[model samples]
Structure formats: C-alpha cells, structure tokens
Target: MKNLFFSREKIVQTFETLQGLIDGIRADGKIKNEEVIALKSWVKAHNYLEMRRPFNDIINIVKTAVSDHVLSEDEILDIKYVCKKFLDTYGGSKMGHLHGFASGIASDGELNEVEWKSLAKWIHTYDYLRGSWPYDEINALVHKHRSTLDLSSEEKEIIIYYFNDFCGLNKNSSLTHPLNEPNKPITGICAVCPDIEVYERTFCLTGESKKYSRDEITDKIFECGGIYKNDMSNLIDYLVVCSEGSPMWIYSCYGRKVEKAIAMRKAGHPIQIIHEFDLLDALEDAA
Candidate 1:
C-alpha cells in the first residue's frame, strides 16, 4: 500500500475492487437475498451497456444465479471465468498481482486460511495483472513465425487461443495447416466454372482434410485464381468446409464469422459455403 508506482497502485486497486465484488456475493458460498439485491443495485448503477456484450452477459448470469436462490459451485466458476476473461480481454496489468495478492490477504477482512487459499488459487489460476492481452500482436507473432514444422501441444494451445479469441476463428478452422495467402493469385481459372473467375474472390476454409493436405488445398486455391482466408467475413466469397461432425463443429461453425456471413447473405451478399470435395472437383475440372 506504500511506495507503489501510480499505475501499479491503480491496477491493484481495480483487482481488489473486483475481488471484493465477487467475494461479497460468495462469502458464504451461497448468495443471500441481500447479496442479490446489492448485485442488482450494482448492475443498475454501472453503465456497462456501452461496453461489450459479455459485460451484459455477466450481468445476466448474476441474475440467473440469484433466481435459483442458491449459487452453485459451477455458477461461481462460470462467474470467475467470465470475470477473468473480461480482464484478460480488456485491461489489467500483470505486474499488479503482487499488490493484489498482498491486498487480497485482507480482502475478506482477515488473513485466515480460507482467504489465503482463495487468494493463492486465484493468483495462480488467473492472469489478473496481465492487463489487455495483445491478441492481435500475439496472433501476428505466431503467424509471422508459423511453419510446416508440427507445433508442440503448447504451441498449438497458443495458436488455438489466437484463433478462438483474437481472430474469432473456429475450432474447425485448421491451425495445424499453414495459413493461405491473403492476396489473390496472379492467374488461373476453374475449368468447371471458368466464367466465374476465382481471382480476388476471398474464401475462408474450415475443418480437417482427409485426401489432400491443407497446403495442397491452399495451393490449388491459389492456382485456381482464388484468394484464401482463414476466416469468414463479408469480403469472403466462399467457405470451404472440409470435414464435419467434430465434437464442437456445430458450435464453431455458427461462430461470429459464419454468423456474419449469414447476415451478409441475407443482405444480398454472394458468399457460398462449399465442401472440400466441391472444391476438389472444381480444381479437377480446371486441370
């Protein structure tokens, strides 16, 4: 609390504030009526509506937790996860953890074993101080250094997080494969549809392939005068779904980019999602 740098103090203060809020409701491991009333009052007081949708989602989850009159352990974890996610996504400095831990010792107005364990667990589990993850920077760093060399499990986790969080790409989006070139090919035509030139037509690809390697597929796309992208956007003309029925395939497919594509289609965009075989057939026809 003393001799602290101004910025570090601010981050610590913010962390403690959040910790206090969460602690207030979960003090007895059950949410009481008074706690629910207090939470509602806090929600009504904060103008987080102008912020991201997740903030509102946090509010809603609090309401749901209170609706049951008992907050389950799973609900507490969910709340914690969302709060951690919000902090990770938006802001907080990693260096402020020491102060937060120090202050959090007395967060529940005591340095008891339970409070200590909670502080330790929270400190270890969440990167509370590491404010504002540079998702774009991390993603760019990964892509710039990406290679055909198989990624280790940790590396894969990093890339997957980038796709899931930063790029908003789905699990179906192939990260193991080298990313396709963003630029259009110099020249080529699909023999099956030579009239419909693929050049400058942005295409987002998803799912794993069986017959052809991802690189081969990307090469064929480039050879067919198409622009290959890793995600679906209004700029995308096609979505090449390679495989289906993966555990979370449905959820990942309906992610932000695909939903955006759907909306764009409704607005008269000419985007189409085709299977890998369809793509292969087009290439074979051109060949």
Candidate 2:
C-alpha cells in the first residue's frame, strides 16, 4: 500500500514538472537554443521516460514557432490551447507546475515576455482567491527549501515580487515608487503647459491605463525627471488621466482623487488634468 501511494505521488510530481516545462517553452514566444537545451537536458537528467510522448508534442509545437524566431498571435493562441488541453488530462500541483516553469526559464538568466505571459495566465488560473495564490505558494516553497534550492536572497526576492505583480497584489517594495507619498505637488504656483519639460514636474495618476501599469508609468516618470504621487494635493502640477470619459472610470474609479484635484484647482491651485498620451508625449520630449 505504501509503495502504491508513493508511486501515484511520483507520477503526479512528474506531471507537474511537465506542465512547468511546457510553460517555460511557451514563455517569450520563441524558444531560445538555451531554453531548448535546458528543457531537454532537465527531462533527460530526471529520466522522465513516461512523459516523453507528451513532452515531444510540446517540443514540436515550440519548434514550429522557433523557425521564425517570433510568436504570432495565432501561434500564441495555439500554444495556450495545447497547454490547457494537456492540463485537463494531467492536472497535478499548480504551484509545483508554476515553480517548475519559472525555474526553467530563470535557469537561462532572465525570464522574457512570453514567459511572463505564461506564468501570469497560470497564476490567475490558480489564484488564491480560488485556491492558493501562486505568489504565496512560491514564497512558502522557497522558505521550506531555501538552502536546498540554492536560491540567493535576491533571486528569492525577485521571484516573490514577480508573482506578486503578476497576481495583481501590487505589494510595494523599495523597488517600486510607493503610491503613498507625503510631498504633494503644490499647484497654483506651477505652470500648466503642454510643452513643459518632464523634469521636476509633479504628476498624479488616475484611472486605468490600457497599456501601462502604475509601476511602469512611475518608472517612466522618474526616468523623465518627474515625480509620481498617488493622491491629489495642492502640490500636484499635472493629473494624468488614463481613462477619462468612460463611465466606469468616471463613476467607479479615482472619484475621490479627481474630486480633490478639481477642488484644489478651483481653490486657485494650478493642477492640470491631462490624458495619458499627453504624459507620454511629455516623456518623449524630455527624452
């Protein structure tokens, strides 16, 4: 009985590893020579003979993408469909699968865009809101086997934060500009000019940006010599509105921030509420 149970557990583990392998391959759209070597090498090293058929299927699919060295929309959709199909039959440990995939991609030094898409999809699919959050699970796993995994403190931190951002937890660290800042940009004194240089400009962002995350926008702001603040105050020089005129954005989002900025402006503060594109232009001009 003990042997039978252990055997079943091992099989499940194998499936999880397989899922991770597929994910790592799908990440970054095109499989790199290094990734192909890493995947095939890892499987062979582990002696996953039973998984050879399905593994080869995935490898073939990836190879189709590799010929062009770019993943098209159709190719991306096909890969996602194939991965889902495989998961349906051999669903094992979601956390194990994610870790496996993440580790495989990171093995090559940096996780790419395709890889992030794969991880984010799986993380959302297994969100703790339903079962276990991938971020928490990975962190726990690292803590349990930190030394065994040979994880550097920095590597562990990166993995944890990646999962957090992927899962939309947005947990702020020193790496991110904090949403809450004490120095509100004073308004009335500042000029509201479209031609204003981004350097030393104070910006308060509101509404959902379609193409940029808050962090990305903040990073751009810093790069352009601008300051990003989450709230509105007399000190804010510009309010970058990403989603204006949309009912959801106007009614359900940033209502308070918008109101406060308006009130400050009415009170003779010089805060100008501009569109996200305008902010981008300002950044480009400064660049």
Candidate 3:
C-alpha cells in the first residue's frame, strides 16, 4: 500500500540504512543494489568490509525508484538539504557527479529550480572536481536555470567552478561541508589538537582515558591536523603518551605554548618553556 517505484517500505528502509552507517553498525543490511551484491561477497570474506559506496548513489536510487516521488521546486531544494546531512552523517562519494546529474534534469525543465539548487549545493560542496567531465553534461542540461534563478550568493557559490575544475562548495552557504571532502578541515573549539574520530584510533586510545568516550581518540587528531592510517604504526604524528589520564604528548596548538612547557617539565624534559597559548600574546581572545 506504499507507492509505485518506491514503497513506503523502501523509503523507510533507505533512511534507516543511512542512519545505520552513521552509527557504525558494521553489518551488511545497510547496503543496497550492486553495492549490496558486492558487499555480500566482501562481508563473507572479511565480515567487516566497511562500506565504501558513495552516498550520492543511494539518493539517486531512491529518487528513481519512487514512482510517486514527484518533487516540487521547493521540495527538490529541501531534499538536497537533507541529502547533505544524510551524506555527512552517513558518508558518501562522487558528490559532484550527483550535482551534475541533477543539474541536467533541472536545467532542462525536467526538474525545477529547487532540484537544480539542491543538486548544485551537493555538487558545489566539492572542493575539487567540479564542472569537470560529466559536469559538461550537467551544464549543457540548462543554461536557463543558470541565468534565470538569480540565486543567492551562497547558492551561486555552489556552482562558481572556482579553482578551475575545482569549483565546488558555495563559499557563501552556511551548510556544513560533506564528509566526503578528503581534505575538509576540522571545525570545532577544541583547545588542543583533537584525536582522530575513527574507530581504530579511538580503540587504541580508549582504555587509557577513564573519563573519555572511545569516539574521542581520533576526534583529537581531527582537531589537531593529525593523520589516520588504518593500522597502528609510528606514522602517527604524536604518541599521546599517557600518564595516568594526563596526556603525555605535548601538542603545539596556537595558544597552548605555556602549557606545553609545563607539561614538558612535569615529564622531566629539561629547559622550562612557555605553553603555546601563553606565548601567543596577541591571541588574547584564545586565552
């Protein structure tokens, strides 16, 4: 009793799977289509072949599958916003492709401004790979929408094609960046470099912290511009040498200069030094 292409069942199922990926379920039910087929084999081989399918694929599938899923112009825009959050929390790949795909339909009047902007925002989130290859296909879809909408600065930012083919991301848009941006910088108020939020990194640092959640290990790395190699290796930027819950590794954050010095002294490293925070006088706001 759901609908045609997509049943009420499929819609519910789609969003649920998206949530599972976000929660790190580590199971097979979360995948669909060829991804499901390929994942079945991988799961049997390792029972832990974490999903790598692009999030854009899922949205496209859902859109095509739902027979009654006709979207109004505003609805198209709304869906695009949801797609960003879904992909951010759930993970994705080839975001620019999704944008180009949408642009083609919306530009040609097969879709509307809402759809065009939605696809554009998703694709625009890309820092690189915008308006390249398939993008021409997307661009050729409709110049009318491109010229007629008078999109806001933020909406326009999504399609500016800046940095050459690298034009993605509506610099003016306030939406959070997609998770797929490989070099997307971390944003938060962490005073010290945050640890990597990945499972492996969290596992490595968990048992040591009494008050910490396992998720915060890699989160610290994200805060501090650190790396996340799959397995534990010296490739790590810092050891985070722990002294009974006190961090042993000294971080060089913008404002923690004095604390670093004190920490060094406590660890018995010779020469008193100031914490980065204390040394940075001009950074009073940070203090």
Highest-scoring model, TM-score: 2
Candidate 3 lDDT over residue span 182-248, tens digit each? 2322121112322122223221221134444434544554444434333333332222322234322
- How do all the candidates rank in terms of TM-score, highest first? 2, 1, 3
How well does candidate 1 match the true structure in TM-score terms? Answer: 0.30
Superposed Cα deviation of residue 28, candidate 2 (Å): 1.2
Q: Order of all candidates by lDDT, from best down to worst?
A: 2, 1, 3
TM-score of 2: 0.34
Worst 10 residues of 1 by lDDT: 184-193
TM-score of each: 0.30, 0.34, 0.20
For model 1, how does the per-residue alpha-carbon lDDT over 175-217 read when each residue is reduced to its tens digit?
2223212221111011111123366677777767778788888
What local distance difference test score does each model get?
0.46, 0.54, 0.31
Query: Deviation in angstroms for 50 in model 3?
Result: 18
Best by lDDT: 2
TM-score of 3: 0.20
